[model samples]
Target: MPKQVVPEGARRRRRPTRQGTVLSEELIVRTALRLLREHGGAGLTARRLGLALGADASTLYRYFTGMDDLTRAIGDELMGRALDGWTATGEWRADLRALGLAVHSSYLAHPQAAVLTASRVTGRPREIAVDETILGILRGTGLPDGTAVLIYHAFIDQSLAFAALDAGALALTDEARTGDEGVWATTYARLPAASHPHIAATARLLTDRMPHSAYPAVLEMLLEHTAAQVAGLNRSQH
Candidate 1:
């Protein structure tokens, strides 16, 4: 990537607000994250961000090239937070499971931001660190390098894909979320048994369970299959 142009001379100096809070790229990205959380996706505009930071909208351009650059920075921050306290155990399967859950939970915590950033490959420092850490974990499992790379691709993609999809649901407006949450209970549960035997038969279970995201269960399945594959590869090598 080409070097992002920083504003010249005077603009490079810290700009203090009337309240004495200094503005910098870090502060801007942090404020943007808050704006995204309090307001939804549409709330993350230059005007709103400026208001939130107590700086002029034009000041933002001095820091970020545009909204896209700021967003990628925010995404990199999210990746950093996911692995904040994570240290890998020598046990590969357990370590991967922990990392996967950490990533999922971090995105869920910032659903609005995740909606914008989860599918993106930011290539920023923290994002690159996450990619490296995951690949290392998979390779340590003793899978062949080729197999490790393939599984690493699948694991990371699946985790982020589901995170984005689930976060999209969570990011809905209150009314929409409520209506969606009630679908299994209100719609599926009410279908006549004569017309929808299978759905009707399991409607009670579905109503009780369907409102929850299934990412955790799905992650476990992926990890278990990968473990099985690794074990089989080890046996064959011996």
Candidate 2:
């Protein structure tokens, strides 16, 4: 006789581990995030996650189909964190600025996880909720549906793109990151004005600013343009 396969739900309902730890999807995701933070992306293996959770490696499958599934959950988890304790300020521009900053900061807080999952579309509840909130914010500005959607896409993508880029740099080893920064200070800052007048003139400012993420500045520019569009619409209506 062939052995029977257990249903996923049944497996999930199995008794707790000998350590008395009850494994849930939330527990697994949080543990995976912690592992990613401590060990980087390459360290987020099933064996490692299982060890961290104090359960057998195969037991994780009771909740998730595989690591890919877990990756989506982890990404959604970051979005959830961004929404936690967040409330809209009623001013569309201010609300959007806060939302973008919240998402960017959440990703940077988990650089390893961001590097792995930033570019993904999780389609999970938290991700969907964030999308809805952003679109609602844009629409509340009295913008047309199509215009609201176009700006929505650009805004969210810009936030994630910058987060991933900065997170990648943040994930680098301390020595490697410092060396990269040193090139700007030693080489760009020392460029001769005669040969490279433009760079030489701005060298000090470049060295000061280049090491930081430009997301905040760019976000403001985008919002400025958006505010202009909203003002234009209001002017025409009156």
Candidate 3:
């Protein structure tokens, strides 16, 4: 499908916030984000981003101090877009499941932007809020604070790790075409049954699995394990 046109506001020029001139983090991030999506990870350098925004590379320096900062901003912005309209109903498991799936879906949606954002936590507002929510859910389970923090960290990391890896492979990596198939055929299916019985048993299931179901299916198993951990903790505390 043809990508959408950049709104006039999304472009940047070296100028202060003046009566007629509009300079914003959103504008800069969005333009760079568009470029990142279209050109893959290597294309999001400060020079190319500037050119895409109709300005010199130096103009971007005014908005973002450096490429790393700019990349983080772009990652945070993409996270925000992925999180729009998400509300919780106080069902902790469902809320967390929803949150994880939301983030995964969002990151996967813009696999380009996600390739950069998923690995690093910029401590951006949306990310902080997401963290707070996850920890809050764990705490609500009545576990001690330390335990809650550890579990929450593990859960968040795992979800993002899987999400980011798949996104990177699908959108950012060069072997997008056959890397997935190679893993299924040459790696998992080839393992001897005596050495990897479970994997070998599930080889056909793994082989028949479609690309789209990969993230969500793995996410379900993660949630199940996490939920059991929470349950175990609850029992121990009682």
Candidate 4:
């Protein structure tokens, strides 16, 4: 028997799912984020995503090549949100601080997704845009190319590294997370003065400071050092 031919357009066309949710790359990434938030990293398989979208698992491949590709898209979506309404205010220090905080907070807001993607190099549009913005801000400091690149690398990696650390703690189960937090108050705060003089003396301070993310303080220090470097360069040019 002769085979019947299907038109190219018909083959490419996809109908809306039972829930009337249209599947696009953006939609998939957004839905994937919500699933990650609700179920954590391990629960974000294609089958689950399909169920959440009210569609067949195979339907996702129509948008993304595979799960890895989709994961990268999710990472890019986070970056896009980080920069969504952010604009540079022409002050390099203030701008860098704002950008760093924005990126860090964005990751912390999705701790589960950050666990999966914090270390990934998406090389997608949003990630590339972030890199470009960072380098541009660094260059605007009038620093040499090597220095600008060095600071840019350090700044970005530091932001992600801290975000990943904080997110990991945030991603823990409720009881585990609470137990971890309790250590500062129960164990560290109760350290014996004779055995550990410094820690014992400063236990109260440690307990107060340890629970918060250190990204902001460290970011301020980096910005301050960068500003000093810019000043030295300016002095040398005179």
Candidate 5:
């Protein structure tokens, strides 16, 4: 058989097509997460996301109202992950620790989103679930109703602020990152031996302590206060 002739014009006009999974809202959010992880929060935009997904930027609106809405959804997803399998066992300290660490670790996973979502209290279902869980644990601790709510707010706000600061510091530019952290190191190194004897003496213990190590101590202190309040109520009952 004779070979068929190929047209040079047709060959020149042909372009290869990309083959892969189609882009969807969940897939887009997941891709945004990767971008956030790699480039930080400012990097998350419809254009960038579309480029990542190989789709038109407008397609994202089909799933989300806007970037703000999309970010909220991402936050909700994070909260859900953090609350996975959480249960109250009527042990206040253990329950509080679990919730605090879960929220902290969740935001740590996506530092950029943590900054965006941390300040905004979305009364959305997952967030409400978290609130309910904490309230349930605090109530189960045998504290009065008002006392339980107060402790819940105090603990939650404390945890959220610390987590946000930790995430934000990590996301800073190299110059900013070095400067912010280096200040603490520099501050102590220059502390006078005579004028600031106390600061000079304990500077080693203060400087060498990691945020992780110190945070739990602070949390324990807060829990201690909560425990004291609960203990007072118990004593009064007796």
Candidate 6:
């Protein structure tokens, strides 16, 4: 089939069929996301996507070159959602914290999709904007150019790494998720105090807290260390 060339940033034109269902790029991407959520990562094939969208599997290629292209679009959409409605305050540390939390929360919102796309570098609009925003924030810290770049690399990579890892845990099958959650309460809590004194001493707290994702705490630690480094730089420059 010939490629259907669509203009950049143009709303996907929906083609109405005798079946009465309209198909567009946005519709395809949204359907793919839904399939991923409902059926897990293996659920997002072209056949399943077509079945969900009420179109032929071949119809997807008109919008995306193939499944890989489609996945990248999905990744970009996640990035778009992460930065949506986000405005940076002039305070660099506060702004970075808000941005980090926004990214983490957005990924957790669609854990299955996040597992698939969180590590991808989609050079699309929203992804590009996010990269630029991170660099801009780091530069605003008054660090030397080399230091700002290094911190930018660490900050962005650390956020994405944690987001992907946490989302992966969340994207597990229901049975797997239940089993994993139970490990802290069922297994660890049952350990003998004589054999594991430290664990037994704090078993209750561990069981309560271990079920929660550690992304927020980890992100705060990263920001705090970065802030300390920035402070050191300021002191050295004076």
- Top candidate on TM-score is 2
Which is better, 1 or 3, measured by TM-score? Answer: 1
Write down the TM-score of every candidate: 0.92, 0.94, 0.77, 0.93, 0.82, 0.87
Clashing pairs in 1: none
Indicate whether candidate 5 or candidate 6 has the larger TM-score.
6
Q: Write the per-residue lDDT of candidate 5 for residues 49-112, one digit (tens) a residue.
A: 8778766677576566678877877777777778995665666799898788888778878888
Better of 2 and 3 by lDDT: 2
Q: Considering every candidate listed, which one attains the maximal lDDT?
A: 2
lDDT to native, each model:
0.86, 0.90, 0.74, 0.88, 0.75, 0.83
CA RMSD of all predictions: 2.4, 3.0, 7.0, 4.5, 11.2, 2.8
Could you tell which candidate, 2 or 5, scores higher by lDDT? 2
Number of colliding residue pairs in each model: 0, 0, 0, 0, 0, 0
Arranged by lDDT with the best first, the candidates are 2, 4, 1, 6, 5, 3
- Residue-level lDDT tens digits of model 3 in 191-236: 9999999999999888778444466676677678777877887788
What would the per-residue lDDT of candidate 6 be over residues 1-238, giving only the tens digit for each residue? Answer: 5466455455343566446766677777788889989998888898988777777788787678788788999988877887995787888888888888888888788899989988888888888998889888888887778988888787778777888888888888779988998999989999999999999999999999987877778778878888998999889988
TM-score of 5: 0.82
Alpha-carbon lDDT of model 6? 0.83
Per-residue CA lDDT of model 4 for 1-238, tens digit only, reads: 3233343344343677889866667777989999999999889999999999888888777777678888888888888788885788999998999999999999999999998988999999999999999999999889999999999989999999998999999999989988888898899888888998999999999888988899999999999989999999999999
Model 4: how far is 62 from its true place, Å?
A: 1.6
* Cα-lDDT of candidate 2: 0.90
Point out the higher-scoring one by lDDT: 1 or 4: 4
Record all residue pairs in model 6 with backbone atoms less than 3 Å apart, i.e. clashing. none
For candidate 3, the TM-score is 0.77
lDDT of 2 at 217: 99
Decide which is better by lDDT, 3 or 6: 6
Q: What would you estimate as the lDDT of candidate 3?
A: 0.74
